[model samples]
Target: MTWNYAYSQDLWPAMISVASTIFLGFYSWNRRNVPGAKAFAIGCLFAMLWAIGTSLEIAAMDFSTKIYWMKFHALWQIPTVTALSCFFIEYAGLGRFLTRRNLVLLSIPALLVFSLMVTNNYHQLIWTSFELEEYVVAKYGIGTWVSIGYANLLGLVNLFALLRLAIRSSRSRWPVAIMLFGQISGRFMYVIDSLYNHIFSPGESVLVVIGLSCSLYAFALFHFRVLDPILLARTIVIEQMSDGMLVLDMQGHIVDINPAATEIFNRPASSLCGRAIVEMMPSDSGIEVQPGKIELTKFEINLGLGDAARYYSLGLTHLLDKSGEALGYLLLLHNTTEQRRSHELLLDKQRVVATLQERERLARELHDSIGQVLGYISMQAQTAQNWAVAGNTGKTVPILSRLSEVAQEAHADVRESIFSLRAGMESEWSFLHALRKYLDHYHTSFDIDTELLLPEELSEDILNPDVGIQVMRVIQEALTNARKHGGAHKVKVVFVEEDGYVIISISDDGIGFNQADLILEVGKHFGLTFMRERMTQIGGSVIIESQPGSGTTVVLDVPIGT
Candidate 1:
């Protein structure tokens, strides 16, 4: 029995008290710079005093020493409760209540208790009677009960303050509530211990409660960031963000749209918040997403109407709850209209520079080829005239033949120049109409029966300018090949759309060359090669079918709007 008593007195309460003191002291130090730190630290100091005084009282062998430390333990009780109450008030954002007049009023009870505890020798106010039990003195008095009731009242007020703060905060409230519950449970057990007089053990069970409460406080501080406003202020930052934001519920209906989103959509927030996302998206933007699916990749879309068309890059994210269940979706839109405009302007400048360079090249070619050919023709005509004056008839005849040959060569050079210029410039409706007329004239000049077929819906807008130019070149080349190489002379030109493609087929009933002969004589089909290359460059294809006796057909397939 003596060994059990020593172990209970020296080991149990000492171990629990020391552990609680170390942890609470460390917690107080860590948050020394936080708001309400001074009040919280004062509470910690009182708690440490309670723990150490209890341990020293347990270790004291004499009744006098035990009684002396008992008073010391009681000395810290009022201060601890008072300081914790102050901490709770500050934590609840009610610091204004801690005025000089209110604080002095609050301090009266603690000061009276301290004076009574120190002057207890003169009168047995705090301890009316005492007796030694289990090598420790246990005291009883009405004053002790009064102090206990008073401390408990202060604790209840602090707990209520914590609950109020938890309910009012916009951030997560569960952590604070959990801490408050822990304190409540600890205080309930302490009341039971004080009433029953060590139903478990003398002051040992209360120390365990204190340790548990301290753990709860630390949990709330670290996990919930109880003293910081980082999570609480997120709503303010999001409200003022520059990029547009829209939040959608699981049904894909817009639930919230911020001011920036309203500005970007050019609509008031009232109009956008309750509408469906599909109804709000611009026509022809081609945005497709499945409901509830997480889409992290962003896409670009052209929005707005006509001349005010603006571009936006959009991203979607899934919003999740604490349990990781998908709640809804968040859409973010960033305006990229200005950047896209600058890019297109840069492309336009490059095209203009390219056109100027091509014009300079044409001028140099005219000077080198046509100009020299005309000069040669003038010299030959002069020579022929001089020979005629000299009466050299034979020499003049041969010179005349040479002059005729030079003139024909110059005519071919002029025709080639005209064709080259037309290929570069034929992009609009006027060019297409003029080309159809030219085709009619060419067939008449060549004495070939020709038929032209065009679709009723064919328009210049359906074709890109660069692709149209290449298409014209390819058609002109095909016609030249059919008229020059083929003997039979019935031709047909057809323009039609099929399977998202614009097909131009030129067919001729003529003596066609063998496909096998193309390998042996590649140079003989240079026109076909050039036609295939031009179509391929513009994301199109060409197919040629020809045989010895059968007709020849060249089909050019270009993607619509390519």
Candidate 2:
């Protein structure tokens, strides 16, 4: 009910527009983890504030009914321009690959233009405000579109940059492109119309809203993949590979074995518990068990391998401990199926080479040991046997005072034979055979059946060195505790799938104690405490359930990120 030109009807839209923009700004600020989310959101903050500031002039005019054009709403154009400019840069990816020099050069345009617009707004540059007949009209200056032709020009540059980034990233750009199309095209049209007259003054905010929602939709679609990118990629490659791949831990237990590996070994991963590498390969080149970043020779098995006649060039690398011991080996096998013909000829050549090596080892052994021992037999026959066991029998010259060599020839022959056997076996059998043998010994010694469950798909996720060792540790601790504390008849361990987690359970019908009571008393054994700590260190939680005379159940649930 105010007088003419006093209360502008457009004030309501101004408030609502700015308030919505500010809300978006605050929402994006809180979600800082999202990439590029801050850019548009931050720009919206300034845009909203400036929008409110611009509308305040309407209130001032309502109070004073001022005819002064430069009094109130006019000053707001500066901040609005500044906010939108920055927003455009981020949404368009204009700053992504921008050099420092390029940015510095770009800043110069704003300095020269912003001041010019503020001082002479009604005449030149992006827009010019002219007076129409009465009603205090502001007409468009020449080439003035959306009150800022220069602003739109800069915006186009930003949009093009964003388009390029979306295209070049080799990523899904459908969602982003949809968002940009809605935002940039809508804004472009508005800017073009504004140059002619007051055609599309403020309706472009609707398209801006659409753009934000599309971006959020895109983020939701892509978030889970970011957590475990390699797992998804592994699934794609598992079936495609031709060569066999087997992964194992330090204890020679199966971590993950591919379809080809299972076919070659005639066993699934679960059945090959603690199996030694020697049992499968049983070749001279398979004994190197050191972990971390090693290139080992391919294991050759000659039960007359038909199609697998070619040598496999194996690359073995180890993860290490801080004390510099091998933690585990990463095994990669390159199939050299095309080289078996060449290899047969090479093997013939290798036999000749080995004959030379054998002569040298014997000569060195005699020169370094047996011949010396025979000479020293008169001096120290009793002492030579003791010296050989000490691994330094050849370190000293024949002793002069107490020549006590005991059965020196026999002792030297035994030592030489043992060394040769170890060297031969080290190259012959792999860890798989050893692991299976160890598990067999455990079953025989403890009279407990150990069960292993494996997944159908052998994956890099399951084969990771840290993860495999942790699983083994969990199993080891659970078994040790069951044997020590749980006075039960039968021990059962079941691995099941639950809520994207690999669930493990160890339980026995032992004399159970109240877990809650024992924890409260602090007087019980530290075994449970140690187990709990180990589980906690690996980002997994352990639950213990027990009662007086009932069996105890220990559950460890681990996430595999598959």
Candidate 3:
């Protein structure tokens, strides 16, 4: 004989379960790449299977058919707790502990239980007897209690894991808390139904509770952005990056800091968060600004903590909303202590090498100029002595006068070399001060009138030492060229800031050579080439304005970034 099944109102709980299953399954599918999503999907599949089997059992009218459906439903029920445990572990960021070996071990009990229920006819271990009362099927056996006990144990484990995670992370606590409460309530209802007959059929109240809980979960997932916190925390690329990151609110307070940031600040994230950023900044950092309208700022800062000091290049950008309103600031700190130190050390080595090379060049110039003049004077003295010994006084007078003139020329050359060497060795003056001293000396020595036009608001500290050196060298070269080559009698210098650059202009009231002559005979005019190279090295430019019978004007434009 064949049996036909009829629909039952009791299947409402199963319908709800199926709907929840579809929603959760789709949720898991959408978040397939997300951590723990596979485990969540597995749990949803098992839950859906449980709902289908339970629906079949409730719809059956005969005792044997109900028993058959009940046994089939046990297949879904037996693994539900295990799958939930796996999901909970992964969801809590404790997936490292759930190895393949551990999973296989966990599956053993579920498999054994499933097998016992399927072969209940041969062994009677799952259900020794079955009875139908008011269209409800109830089973009694040692296996029934054992399955409940095992499932409860697994549920307890999942609850504990989620509870631990909820306690640890403030961002994801609510969702985990809700899941824990739901599992406890559903298990309590299951135990109550098993102990005494209730208005709701066996497993119906539990399914209803679970289904409601899943709905709540889906709501939390879509509505609250519940997954983002854990996702960011576990993403290996961001977590492992070396650059420090900080997310700040518009209140100038520290909101969130990454691990690298924590290390950079030399404080734990717990203590650093919620504190005002001004308190953490170095005294010289100059980061003072209103909270909401953070300016686009980029600079290097040095933070000193006892014996440990580090340099960091700080960059601040406005975190804007979709409508372009200011949300907060994203601060990126790139640690540059090692790189800066290496660069400084390299500069130091270069300076030493340059000093040695300069000394060699000076030695060669001395030998070629003053030394040659001195040797010529010695030869003239010997010739004058021979002329005097021969009593040729008439020839001696002109020869002695020539010797005196050569001696005077050598003396001037020696004085000039000493002045040049002294100027090269003086390394500790501000750019403006050094240029002033140089111009004063030039005016006093050459009797040239000098005028200086300087911006009073210019801060000396803003100029980089390296840039100052290059600028000063260019000024010196231009002044020397004006006095010697162009015979400049009056000079003017002006300093101004324009378009993110510092411009210094030096003009002379001297006869100037043709610009074409300077370009064509570049080898003879090494000073202009040196000035151009020095300006270029510091991301600056040089402009020369000159023509024959017109005074030359040299303008140096240097970017302020350096």
TM-score per model over all chains: 0.45, 0.37, 0.78
Task: Please give, for residues 102-219, the per-residue lDDT of candidate 2 as tens digits.
Answer: 6566556555554555655455653344443322335544433433555667656656755764543323255446545655664555455444443433322322332343344335
Query: On residues 424-481, what C-alpha lDDT tens digit does candidate 1 reach at each position?
Result: 5544445356556667766665677778888888874556666776677777777766
What candidate 3 gets wrong by more than 4 Å, as runs, is 1-4, 96-99, 121-125, 135-149, 156-170, 195-200, 225-241, 266-268, 280-298, 304-308, 318-328, 349-353, 385-428, 446-448, 452-468, 477-562
Candidate 2, superposed: residue stretches over 4 Å from native: 1-10, 29-42, 53-104, 121-137, 142-149, 168-175, 200-361, 364-562
Backbone clash total, candidate 3: 0
Backbone clash count for every predicted candidate, in the order shown = 0, 47, 0
Between prediction 1 and prediction 3, the one with superior lDDT is 3
Each model's lDDT: 0.73, 0.52, 0.76
Question: Could you tell me the TM-score of candidate 3?
Answer: 0.78
lDDT of 2 at 223: 55
TM-score comparison, 1 vs 3, better candidate: 3
Error of 2 at 41 (Å): 5.0
Every model's Cα RMSD, please?
Answer: 12.0, 22.0, 4.8
Evaluated against the true structure, the overall lDDT of model 2 is 0.52
What ranking of all candidate models by lDDT puts the best one first? 3, 1, 2
For model 3, residues 1-562, the per-residue Cα lDDT tens digits are: 1255788887888778877887787778677667777777788888788777778877776777777776676687767778878878887778999999999999999999888877888988777766677655465578878888988988878877887765544456677766777777777777777667545673465365567667766776666554454555554455577988877788878877777988888887778889877788776776766745654343888778644878899898888899999888988889998998899899999789767755675576567567778888889889989999999999999989998888876665465446544554555756666667777876786688899997888877546776777677778778877876788889999989978898999999899878888767766655687688778878999999998889999998988868
Residue pairs with backbone overlap in model 1: none
lDDT of 3: 0.76
